[model samples]
Target: MTFEFLLAFAMLVVASFGHLGMWIALYNRINATGLKRTTIKRIEKAIVLACGIIPLLLLLIELNQHGLVGVLAGLFGGASAWSWLTIAYSVLAGLLGIVLAPFWIMDRPHFAIARDRYQVTSAEDLNPLKETVKNRRLYLRGRSFRKMSKLPGNQIVSLQRNCKRLKFKNLPNDIEGLRIAHLSDIHLTGQLSNAFYRLATDWIAEQRPDMIILSGDILDNEQSLHQIQPVFDGLNAPLGMYFVLGNHDRRLTDPTMVCRKLCELGWVDLGKEQAMRQHQQTTLRLIGNEQPWFQRNPSPYKFEPGRTSPGNEWTIGVSHSPDQFAWGIENRCQLMLCGHTHGGQIRLPIVGPIVAPSWYGTRYASGVFEKNETLMHVSRGLSGVHPFRWGCLPEVSVLELALL
Candidate 1:
């Protein structure tokens, strides 16, 4: 037989065995997981479907290149080097894409159903659990996890705060009815519609916030900026709509463009900057730092290239994650807002999230934690990549801080 025939035969043999090996690996993976039989079956089917499509499409392409009558000739006939390589790479990449694509693209909306399972007994159940009077400032998180269909929502956590002296001199004494709607962890991909933004804008407007603080993860892509702007345009804030960037936003091709687009629509980009005296009778210093992704450090102020004291201002330092305790402590921020972990989108019973990207595990995965009298409220965030909600449901925080 010709060398070309031998090569084609070898390619076919290797590919066939490789495909079988991959299928066995997939089967083993499904069986190894603690998921139910139905889930395992579904996964198995998905793997088979992916495998089937690749070989079928390649066969069709081969047929097109060489008519049925010339199938054998075409297999052995010399093709251009580039064309041959392209076809070979396409097959390899297509196989890889089929295998990994499920992790990246699976849109199981189980979290929504999971939210229905949770019953809130009281307002306290919805709020973070606090043991001391000092911990009255509750922290609420938005849905930030990309959930699988069967996961539970976020686990409610609580912490105690000790305040020897209450410090916000400029803060309004009548801050009882004062409301600030905190929205964070909006990973707005291009799929995000103008309507979602409208819903969010309207929700905040209905809350009648004296101020709105958007923590971070503004956009999944720079293109998403255009889609989200019209919603922000309608965001009617008497004080101002403030914003900070998250790690995801920093991954965009041009994060500055995303920032500029939001700012153009009346939101202030607070990264490494401050907005003073925006509120009545109060010097509300809004401080925002860049995403930890850029600095290669999760701690906000630890590796910050620029150093400046937030200075005895009644400041609310906005960050994407609670990685920076030093910045919050040194600044003496009365309140800090953050969102990144979607509360591990899929949460097990008491074991919590299967995987939470934060350093503190599931402890600080969601809700309020007080560090050195600084009350930090981490919003779970608005939307995530995966559609599941598990233990944590989607949230919109209406924070009312009654100063001690």
Candidate 2:
């Protein structure tokens, strides 16, 4: 055999052993007691055999040089490993079930609270509803505020060194005093009353922010859009109101039309590939890379961070998830704002978020993270899935970038 063949054989041998090792470990560790010992052993054997077959299959497809024929043969052979395939699928389904099961079990209905802080401000003003909807409306209003009333200020501060201050050089001396209200992931389930959004918008208006940046995941469902549209009409800012798509928003039908509806009311969609310059000086690149359902090899141009005049302009990148931290770092972003994970949705007291989906369970679960020179701010977000926020409270971040 040639040197290339020999090398390929060695790699396949190592891969085969590694795959077998994993199966052996699982067989010894897993509690397969109720099942017949012979059955368990057979399953483990099949897993090991499939693992051993993978490298050979890959080699057949990539190195055999027979092209499609070899690829087809490998794929067919891979699928033929029924025993391992069954177990593998079962494991995947179990993991998925674990992840999504929480949403169903923990769906917070309206009107399930003890505190009066979140009660319906105006019962007469509540939106008209169908018979069933009218009954559920009362329940929804009850859970609106829940434990939030007990929290200090109903606002949680995700304090980190990165949020200390953002450095901007050419932030127009005239606009140097500009303040921005940044909010994201306001998953407006039925539990959140229409009055809450109105109150939030009114409160934001009172702050008199120069600009409003709604990062994404505004409404949780189609019904929420109707309730939210009125509240959005109440929002007003000097510069503009910008928004991007979140993972949840993309899951709905006619997402583009939804974007259009918001845009018709002066809300900028800021799709996957769009940039908006501010004050004719700084550039803001908004990338709407919806999460949990990533596209394969999406064009890099989707988030082209145009070159900014150093010491003359500040470019801020906005995204829904901080999953693209490496991309931001590569492009030399001064600041990136994002929200998702909702500070792990439910956090423990001192131990922090039990499981922050992104960042691999790091305390950087929320707030700002400073790596070298780049600053990434992951907001605690504005609303909770349920009213059970133990440690991490909802928030609206006021970010002031100063020219230093």
Candidate 3:
């Protein structure tokens, strides 16, 4: 082929990749956010038609045409389309990051400490849990949106076990070896079964965490609560089990009933509340802040770091969304735990997480981040709205807090 034809072909290839990336980013945003079903469906249809069908038609038209005019037309059209698509994606992404600039900047400008002092001493990946009978029924017969996503069988059953030993300078000496088993986004709907959670809890029990904290999205459908109630009840933690209401949990028909069920199972409902626990001679304060997105009451409780004396107490904040990390820091919390990003549910090798729902995008999407005195750990989460997980795997975080 001539140089002109090669150039035209290369432009078409680049535009196709750009289109795919844009759609993938959009889909990730939909999965991360709790949008209405109708809205999501409409968006999906549009993406398929515009990004998929229209491009194919354009390519076919270009191929059917003849001579230098056709080649030049294809090159110019492809280049123009790619430029517009890139600009649109960048503009939207930039706007989101800009809006959350305050929270992102607040977490910066921290005291520098030795890198070795804060390290992952141990990182272990647990085995995948056996799929339960109920899980099979749900995946095969459930009418959930995930079923319609056309997820692969392996993606549905795959789970990543992340047991990390994180050491930080701000960790208190008394609770220095504290192990907190963090589980989040356990969207226990028809797609996932109680047995999946049973295996997770059993594994956690084996680790013997001092405390167990669930960040949010415990129940997807209110009806499935009965099946998994026993699994959650069976969880054993020395300092007891604490939970915060996630956006999905709030979407339930009777969100209060869900909290009541957990409370009945002996789990503390830490929604918009604070509790203190004494581990040996050390006193630790735990605060659960549920943002007002879907909450019914949306408590007016505020955390004022200046009012409370640091004293000998260590404060830990828990929220369903990592967006609360800034609030936690302002409240003088030494450590914060969160989920809800689901690690973008699909991460690329070099590009990382393309779509994280948080206002700051994927800044605090997953893993550990330390900003000054506050250290936040975001779990990949146990489950997600979509059954398919590409590079991102479902995870149960076993955090071991240590002092420098």
Please rank every candidate by TM-score, starting with the best: 3, 2, 1
lDDT order, best first, reads 3, 1, 2
Indicate whether candidate 1 or candidate 2 has the larger lDDT: 1
Question: TM-score, each model?
Answer: 0.55, 0.56, 0.74
Off by over 4 Å in 2: 1-175, 280-288, 291-309
lDDT of 3 by residue, 259-317 (tens): 88888877887884577899877788888877734554334334464565345677778
Clashes of 3: 0
Off by over 4 Å in 1: 1-176, 278-280, 295-312
lDDT of 1 by residue, 1-404 (tens): 78877876666655665565455446544533435446667987988787687677766665676656455565575551223643674566556546643532232223212232122221322222234433222222223321222133333222111111122323465443456677877667643345444545666677677778888777876656666666576675676778887766756777778778877778887874577754445556777755445442223323235754333336678777766545777766777777776655556665455444444433445566666646666666766655555566555566665534
How far is 352's C-alpha from truth in model 1 (Å)?
2.8
On TM-score, the leading prediction is 3
In model 1, the Cα lDDT at residue 340 comes to 71
